[model samples]
Target: MTDQGLGKDDKTPRTARGERTRRALLAAAAQEFGEKGFHEGSISGITRRAGCALGSFYTYFDTKDDIFRALVADMSGQVRDYVSPRIAEARDGIDAERIGLLSFLEFARSHKELYRIIDESEFVDAAAYRAHYENTAARVATRLAKAAERGEVRPDVEEVHAWAIMGMNVFLGLRYGIWDDSRPADEIAAIANALIEKGIGTRPD
Candidate 1:
């Protein structure tokens, strides 16, 4: 896949050192935007936080909006990278869904600023915001379709089911991971997974 994490006009970093510097800038941007927001976040602030010279900023990013857009895409990839391996460890399709939710909660707790950056992206970079969710839902849909082929889930499972699960996980992360973490992540995942196993309707009508 193309590095959507880079600015539209920016080229990929060549040397290992260049790659490290670029990653450092992205990390700093996350904290900058997470605390002050896109409108208030400054290039100088990111450079200072990254421990790089102000001139170094121009080498990686063209403008503040460019970095902010890149940050949103970067964070989206971070979440997927963290959770994908755990999801792969699941024994079956349903268990994979459960593992996915549990990993996401853990990630949210550790990266509290995730919500701030992603939520603000809706206004600062609408395209990146929509792409984030759309890409995630597509992954879920692909998984569900594979499970159907394996006879691990209902044959009729489709894209609608993928989006439904995504919606449930997003809100659950906000409520349990951001608002509060008094509840156990595994416990929450188990409760949600049952809905996948058994329809929530009064009967399978």
Candidate 2:
């Protein structure tokens, strides 16, 4: 539920209806931005997609740039929320990673716009782009550290290791999730999991 980097303020909705309106705007913005890059996407297109008025758009976001930033944060939270519980259900630390990737592939397949929007954020909003990946890597590092404490992985597991794994997942998701999804998600996860296990799992001397 991390807000990425957005802060709550007076603009934040207090009513359920207001929240729904804001969410609709964000979802519509995702479609508009996803189909058309930031520069091409327009605020009017977002309102049209959301079935709301121009005034309604301003009700939640001050401008297109504002919503785009919010979208990045929202999507980051969405990914974490979708994958974390599934990972928590894993039998062990290594299994958690396998589940994590499997869930992410499924998410990417369904939300194909995810990659395009996130990638575009690198140029459109560098701060949000960096925050998204940094937050993701931090989560991975935390999980790895916990796994190590549980004797499930090498005790020396560190941030660099987490970044490495995150890097692999990002591309793996692009290949198996966005570009094409003919292959089974679990199959991809298992393959990647094996690599992670061999490299980091505890072993006997």
Candidate 3:
């Protein structure tokens, strides 16, 4: 079978214990790659961090590159799972974006290594890197479209608008969330949301 999406290939785990090991390896990889980077990080280091045997690595992953690819996909899914629900609880479309950014900021601040692993994926695995952002942008676009239909945003909003907001959130997460993190999450999100609220936000009657 083809390597479609994250769980691609027949090497997939078949048992509950297998899944736990895979998760441990990915978690260890995040810390390894996040700190040592893809080039410097070693498979040995991952196993050591995961407290698993050396040979056990091959049980789930074929090679170091393979694990890294899976790591990228895992991290992307983590962000979505973390932010999507908070975004859903938002009062409206514009508020949804605010919640999304706020949640992302918290995630980035806590998972400092997340950006490093993802950024390195751009160099190590271009396809996975592109897929992460493209998939995220698509989600944003869908949300915006629904918001438009519900009169939450400007009637003329388009895909470009969603991409723009996603771009904004990405950089904001990098800067305020990952880089400095001195400011409060709500404060930073509100500042960014202000620009969005006026431009895309629907006016009150």
Candidate 4:
């Protein structure tokens, strides 16, 4: 996995240090939760795995649930940031969907642990997980609506189409990023993009 976390490379010393510590804690928490589930995962175990003092954990997060929420927010932001620029760059192109797919697949590859935690959270708390998922889907739908207004996608297509496409990417990430790592990222993304474009993109006369 790529070291994309804000660690030694950040600008502000304090911010950088805090981000490093937070990343460490999240990494440890992901492992603990993966092995034992949320209820069984202990703060002491997470602190120990993170190699940080118990007191330090409280400085950043109040409770395990808080950390879990942070993890979800962070992962969602990462995915949005990954795809936003690519979508913006596409501007008026037919390949915006492809670019978005590749960006998402790349983010999943770099942040597999975070992705796993997000996926696992669904099974742990179905209602809360669905709420979070819907929020993310809504954001994607808004972006797609804007793109459609700009003539990047078919104008007749509804925002639900974008929600469905985002769901497809999430499931694709689960399969390629977590279940199997054999397939190339580009290939997987291309296949996904092809399906979406053919299904919803505007066709020229």
lDDT winner, 3 or 4: 3
Best lDDT goes to which candidate?
2
The sequence of per-residue lDDT tens digits that candidate 4 reaches over residues 133-188 is 78777866776777778887778767678688778877887788767868898898
lDDT of 2 by residue, 79-189 (tens): 999999999999988999999899999999999999999999999999999999999999999999999999999999999989998998999999999998999999999
Clashes of 3: 0
- Top-down lDDT ranking: 2, 1, 3, 4
- Tens-digit lDDT track of model 1 for 1-205: 1235555445567889998999999999999998999899899999999999987777777788888988999999999999999999999999999999999999998898999999998998899999999999999999999999999999999999999999999999999999999999999999999988885789556
Model 2 collision count: 0
10 residues in a row with least lDDT, candidate 1? 1-10
lDDT of 2 at 58: 71
Q: lDDT of all predictions, in order shown?
A: 0.91, 0.92, 0.91, 0.73
Q: Mark the regions of model 2 whose C-alpha exceeds 4 Å error after superposition.
A: 1-8, 199-205
| Candidate 3 lDDT by residue in tens digits, 133-155 | 99999999999889999999988
Q: Model 3, residue 179: what's the lDDT?
A: 89
Report residue 138 deviation for candidate 2 (angstroms): 0.3
Name every residue pair that clashes in candidate 4. none
Error of 1 at 173 (Å): 0.4
Give the Cα error of residue 188 in candidate 3, in Å. 0.7
Cα error, residue 66 of model 2, in Å, equals 0.1
